[model samples]
Target: MSAFDVRDLLKAAGHPGQLKAADAVHYAPTTSAIPPAEVGAPRDHGGAVSPVVLAGSVRIADLVLVVILGFAIHHIQLADMVGLGWRYPAAILSVAVLAVALFQAFGSYRIAAFRSFLKPALRLTAAWSLTFLVVATVMVFAKVADHYSRIWLATFYGLGLAMLLLERFALLHFVTARMRRGQFDRRTAIVGGGPLAEELIRALEAESESGIRIVGVFDDRGDTRSSSVVAGYPKLGTVSDLVDYARSTRLDLVVFTLPIAAEDRLLQMLAKLWVLPIDIRLSAKATKLKLRPRAYSYLGSVPVLDVFDKPMADWDIVTKAIFDRVVGAAMLIVLAPVMLGLAIAVRVTSPGPILFRQKRHGFNNETIEVYKFRSMYADQSDFTASKQVTRGDPRVTPLGRFIRRTSLDELPQLFNVLKGELSLVGPRPHAVHAKTNTTLYDQVVDGYFARHKVKPGITGWAQVNGWRGETDTDEKIQRRVDHDLYYIENWSILFDVQIMLATPLSLVTTKNAY
Candidate 1:
């Protein structure tokens, strides 16, 4: 934790003088606690699942069903009436796209709609019908109806509707089963235990379909001021304990029920809570400050100001996973011969294993074993990287010097990316004891652990921007952290592609690595 003032931020929000000089804020980043064996490990806690994932899966499933069934009906039932040409195939794809858009417009893909079949079934039917109507209109206007069969269109509509209904019913059953196992619930916690907390809890419970399960409440006050329990939920611990609990549990959203006017307390709380990779929101339901409708978002009708949103959520996660797996596999296959040659050269030249594994802090502070080709003498290898490798170090082997300088030793980590322990582009992970000037990296930089919010990568914005190499000075690490934070804040698939493409040019131009 590092102490600083957030007065500037508060002033920008039109609220100032909310804190005394003594109440300095601390931005926290802690050390990793897990071991090397759990590399790319899944979180131990289980139960709650992301609603966005469920909704996205259902939407994709709808598209596949409609496209597959449309082709099936055309081939098996309408081959005689409809000619085999691009017109019918084009129509099926257009209907699938249109149906999906209409369903989204009707709110049929919402999380609430997934938990039941009747509402989604009705919405699906209407959307499907409208899709056919719109497509027919377009065909008629384009004078392309003569090439299509009326019988094919009618049969496709009826079959698509029945198939969609059946899929919805199956999804309803699956959701019900998962809910019974507590998988659909969002494990939420309130960060205040006074009257505001009680009111917020009551309001949340009123919406039974929201799937938010309030695990407990946390407050800094003693039992004398804040009761042991509020609105049937216990005060688990103080605000500090909440941080530890969230790291170890499957906690989803943390809502602050303290008054919006309590700016000092809110700032102090956010300083500590912002490091965790979870959603942090400030309750605005009972606040007197009025803002435009766009400033506030709703969670079951209760307005909240989003303080921090968990990154790489929902479709972002899906997109990154697909990119990493597909691209990583292709790279591995393309580089197989080079990797094999390096492996054999290392074995013959040095008396050690070809690959070296070292534990580094991964996403959410989990310790993961990152792989690299052996680039040092077996007897002098640094497992923990406690001492920074300097220029002209004696531990480097003849072949090691070439590989280390060119970053060819890092090629083995393509395996880590494929295994899900690393991303193709993100903040680079550091050794557990990596430091600058005899001080740990986290101790030197405030909120340093924030970089672990996403998976560490084989290449990153910092490396491509000329920040790769030994961190013998404080300034080097600080610059790296600054660039890493920038990448996280402004991340996209295209941004990642840009970084990866520039990586080779960076390797050739930079000379700091030893």
Candidate 2:
């Protein structure tokens, strides 16, 4: 039968679609019991799942629910006691604030707490009860306990606990349903398909509750030494193939099973793998060497040595996003007049659109349209930027020359920041086909794609530190990459603010503005 006919017959027969030869070779379709590699015994990696998907939303919901419950109960029971004055509502707000603080302190909002319902439910209950006790004690100490009705206070405590418990139960149900569909689990892959990999897979499977779903294994060797299937999992491809696969997939973690003693092999693997934006860990269970307690992190009791971490992960990403939007919006407001004047100048000076939209590499090597005021004549503009703009270029208009020199042409990128395509501060996005000295960027630098681990920004450490503007030479691009890598390795809100403050000064210098 033809392939299409066979596929249709299989679908009609209620079987899954046939796997292609490539898919069959890479994926293990059958689930068979496999022996774990010889290693340490499994221990409790207790707590909620690591990398909760909706942590920020959950926290916000928790706070909102608490406030609603506090006000609802207060209105029902204590409205008449305070005579509709601001004092009672102010007191309720104080209680809500205390509840949120105690919830955070008790680790109620942690990833581990959200993995299971009972733990977080208990935690929420404790936090709420403690908040009530603390607030009641303060009220009594202040000699205002009589001002508040005892019935109202008692009702508030009981109702608050009930409401929090209900919220936790609902959240637990929602997360459980998502987990069953393999939604929240981290998409992980095992590096080095051998005995160590088999052991790691077995351990991860044993603690399936930990939210690590290993897709397959990857090994450089293809001979009988590196079998097509290790344990029950198939060897997807070589490490190089893993890089391409990672680019196409939403891969979260890569657990390397190579021994720590094999420094050369480990380094070789890392050099190729580091280009992708994923967490890379060394399997500690495979080695006999021991390190301090703090040196190890657990993947469900399977200890792994940290090598390279995906920069600005989880809450850091959330905080940076908030900072970008708040700051980006404020800057757009402050620079609107200047941007408007520039837009009018560009439109009148050049017979083209006021804004120049060019495709650039965004976070995780994805393509995004970046905005800037058109700085060159319509007919002469290099959309791909394959040819670098040089000093005294005839294509640059009178207005374009002025704006480009003063960095005013980049003001429209504040909207890109607000649109969430770029950040206020990060490694600047390069044109989709950007080249340095007639060579592609990745060909020039070893781990060039690593700079894309974070969102592209309007201003960056490289820009602020004199690495901005024309990347005419290979050394210039290399130095820019080095500065970007440095920024990624050591990033904080304070560091971003510092770079932002230094940006205007850098712009005024105009060292390489062409």
Candidate 3:
């Protein structure tokens, strides 16, 4: 079926971030587990320039420059500003905000605008001039113009505009260098080969500023059904091979060119590909099915249906990283004395190191060392955690039990948060070999690896909702995974704050923590 039908099927998947089987097809979730050996050593793709991040950063920089220039010009023009109470700072802040709003309304923050020097200079000048005119008119009508000097206002206008243009010129060179190195382009890949794939690739290439770089093509069929090369791009591998390729490399968009009539093939490919944390699109250029204009999103001029979107998009990732480092650092400073006392307690009571390090799966299933206050005895500690800790386990020291139940042992992971290996709120990272009964966590639940789509956290929605502690049964682990997936789908800055606030309350019931 084409996207017209598959779109409806995907709608039934409940959450937009999840994938489910269509009513007509029974998905068994029987695809071979991702070989454990390939979990680490992710291949580097050099550097990737996300347009959203670049655009947002540029916008923020413009605002800062405008505000600074306003203040600098005022101070230079009117050194005796003792009479002005809050008017100067408030006026400059308002002008700065309105100036940025005007720039955004005029489309001055686009990636293409930054690629050239002249276009941005002209646009910024126009927006800045208009911002001054509006503010001056407002001040006059409010009868507040008598409080400000005309000479100061004029100086700010000229100097601020000049400063903004100079910033744009510098940015132009930076963007140009990045473009020459191909860092500004999205690393895209095609999922099918033949006439449809050729048409899609050519259409994308036709747009000179599409910012899409076709890496290669991937198909499961033999050479007889699919060509070895299409539109000057070689076939990289089969569908399974594409999964491994994406996991290792920095792959952005994955466009499927298989015909809409091939429902079974599409279903199977979606089953395998949905687990990946990448954007998946179905090419609608060659499909006979037609949907409303809003139903299809375009890549360049080529229409496609967005099947999946990567969670924690560009700006969200930036915000989360900033929040983690800033808050994590502050927490460390505030709790230093408590942590020191706990360290001393552990060292004195146990015949082991104060800190225990274990390998845990981090973002994208990469192995990272997670730190904790040593809880088990020196010789009895299980670094791999092949054996689960149970209630009243002899390995736990007296001090260790108190720290574990109070969750003071997890304070050391705040360093991991600062190191960018963990978030303050996300799926809790599990030991690489953590399991329930005889089955690995991944085996116990389908799409379990999806939790690693974001960096694991010190605490999460599952923990705050009473899903923390030991998982001895499949049901317990399954519920934890379900809560984790829900958190991933509905994550926001406010949601994270809520989870963090509820964490201490959750620690009261540590019945399951050994």
Candidate 2 ranges with C-alpha deviation above 4 Å = 1-76, 79-148, 173-183
Model 1 alpha-carbon drift over 4 Å, by segment: 1-49, 85-87, 126-148
Candidate 3: tens digits of C-alpha lDDT, residues 17-94: 433312112233222332333223224332667788998998899789878887777777776754446898888998
What is the lDDT of every predicted structure here?
Answer: 0.80, 0.76, 0.81
Backbone N/Cα/C clashes per model: 0, 1, 0
Can you rank all candidates by lDDT, best first?
Answer: 3, 1, 2
Residue-level lDDT of model 2, residues 426-493, one tens digit each, is 99999988888698776665457778878888899999889988988889988898888888888899
Question: By TM-score, highest first, what's the ranking?
Answer: 1, 3, 2
> Candidate 1 lDDT, tens digit per residue, 1-514?
1112232454555544433211221324222322233222225432356688888887888888888888888889777766668887898899988999999998888878888777778888898999999999999999988788888899999888888888888888888888887777777889987788888899889988777888888888877998978998777777766676666566678999888778777776775676667788888865877888898988878778887887667678778989998999999999999999999999999998899999998887778999999999999999989788888999989899899888999999999999899998999989988989698887666567777778899999999999998998878998898788778778899999999999999999888998
lDDT, model 3, position 120: 70
Residue 321 of model 3 has an lDDT of: 84
